[model samples]
Target chain A: MLKIKVKLVDGKISKKEMVLNKKEVTVQDILDILEINRETVLIRKKNELITEEEILDNGDEIEILRVISGG
Target chain B: MDKSPKCSRCGKKAIIDIRYREEKLCRRCFLKFFEKRVHRNIEKNKMIKPGDRVAVALSGGKDSTLTLYILKEMLNKVKCELFAVTVDEGIKGYRDKAIEFAKRNTKELDLTHIIVSFKEIFGYTLNEIVEKNKVLRGARGPCTFCGVFRRRALNILSRELKASKVATGHNLDDESQTYLMNFFRGDIESSLKMNCDESISELFVKRIKPLSTTPEREIAAYALVKGIPFHMDECPYAQEGMRNVVRVHMNKIESTFAGSRENFYYFMNEIIKHLKTKEKMKFKLSSCILCGEPSSKEICKVCELLKIIRG
Candidate 1:
């Protein structure tokens, strides 16, 4: 199980915890599993930017910020 | 992510992994790189000249805010003046928050900020125009009206403020999406004329895009990293536009292929350059007969659209 927090554009935290049966999962892999477009969100761990392929250990908390700017 | 936490330059804790360069950078180094790239772009493109007044079309979004912030930072080095203008299309609950952010940023920077509304310019807010457009026999999307009106409003306000150049926060993503949108629409003329590499008129203020090479993701990251307060909510009518469709697909392609945005930019630039030389397409600029606005033809599209909306 990996802890994921979804942050909306308005800066609000939307809880979205994910539980997978696999023992090892990368950031990109989980995002892919969740069907989140990699380009549409920024992934961060411990308040620092992390790329998509970073491996996630069980109980590791991450924040995925939604990025949408259309005019 | 290879779990590298050290900045490529300083060995500090990394804040971003720039996939294009295949390098990870700390906050300080990332910001330095971002500013340097923007400054280099401005210098290389000759986008700004000494004694020139630049009016930024600030929407308070990440892209425009970063544009204004970077340009303002370059004031001492570039020998230019800067102000900001915000065009309010009067979309309820959408534009109001953005304008507030625009006002806040300008206030903080101590720069002059001007805002013009669609109601004042066209006698109709965007909401009203959309409502009226709905009952009409045949009408374009709200984006069509908003786009035309916003461009006109930006031009008028920038000119009135005695701006020598108008700067918008259109980044690489927006530019590529626009090109793809036109290409998909089968609008070859628009694609060819996208850059306006030559044949610019002296009548209207020249438009500049300093952030053309920077990706939208970088802009958003810069805003957050710098603690720059910005309005992040998208416009309500954005999802209804075809550009949104193109944007989604382009992003998907970008994800699958890192640095594809810049690649598209380089590829497209070469094509546009070759097309301009081979076709000898000199788009002569003319003033609109009714409104005296700069147009490619006798009457501007804004005026033509206004006629339909006012009827």
Candidate 2:
């Protein structure tokens, strides 16, 4: 199981600890599990912004930031 | 497992990781950085003056909310007046909520909020226009109508308000996407000439995008951290057109190559600068036949679109 902490930056939800029964997980997997739009959020692992296909290791701390489009 | 890093500046627990710069910043440091960058952008471009009355195009989205917030703070230091103008395109479910957020922000900031609607300005809402222009369908999408009318409304309102400058929340991602879209369409001249030759007509309000250097994600993070009230909802009509295609491609390119968006933005700026220096394409401005607004052609784009919608 991979243990990860996910923080929602939009303030809609509190930070939560999530565990997945996988050796490694992609950002899209987490977003899918959370039912969040892939285009709307940026996923960051540790101190680096990761793409949807970037794999996350065990005990990773991730931040999800909503993408803001201009008027 | 890698440990979460502290802010590079303050050593606080970092909330954002700026991949392009390889920097981790806490909420406070990030806000400072964001505001400072916006201030620099304004100063570098000479976008605002000490006594300039700037009109902010507030859509109550994360971008415009942060734009108004940052500009308000910066203008406070310079003793400038700011007015918030919102152009309601009359998108049913989307615009009403955004206008509420815009109203709330304007009230909190104590700035004058002017709300203009498509119905008020063009005699038809976007929905009506879209419904009427069924034959013109794919040739020009609803976004074209909305963008042209909304811009005309903002310009008209800005002049009516006697504002010196119009500030928008166009960030790096938006700039890059626009640049790429124009480039793909072989319409780079129009894109470059937009800001380069705005002084050709006094009727056109000088637009200042202070957040052009900042990325969209950073603006979102800043908005959240600063507690700026904004809705995440997008325009219901936004899913169509070349912009959406370009946006997806731009995002994909940005994700694959870090700093690509900023690089593209700077590259576009450099090209614009070069074009301005090389050939100052003087466009003869004439009054639109239908409306008295200044236009390069016989009729302004808004009026041209209105003709189709009114048919």
Residue pairs with backbone overlap in model 2: none
lDDT of 1 by residue, B1-311 (tens): 45545788998767777877888788899999998888888888888889999999999888888889888988978788999999989899989999999999999999999888999988999999888887775358999999888988998888888898899999888889888888778876777756664546656677889999888888888888888999987788888899888888888887778888789888988887777776466566788999888888789889988887877
Q: Candidate 1 deviates by what RMSD?
A: 2.5
Query: How accurate locally is residue B125 in candidate 2, as Cα lDDT from 0 to 100?
Result: 84
lDDT of 2 by residue, B99-174 (tens): 9999999999898999999899888888888887875563688888888888899999999999998899888877
Q: How many pairs collide in each candidate, listed in order? A: 2, 0
DockQ each: 0.46, 0.20
Candidate 1 similarity to native, TM-score: 0.92
Return the lDDT, model 1, position B144: 91
In angstroms, how far off is B172's CA in candidate 1?
0.1
Cα deviation of B140, candidate 2, in Å: 1.4
| Residue B28 in candidate 2, Cα distance off native in Å | 2.4
Q: Model 2: which docking level applies?
A: incorrect
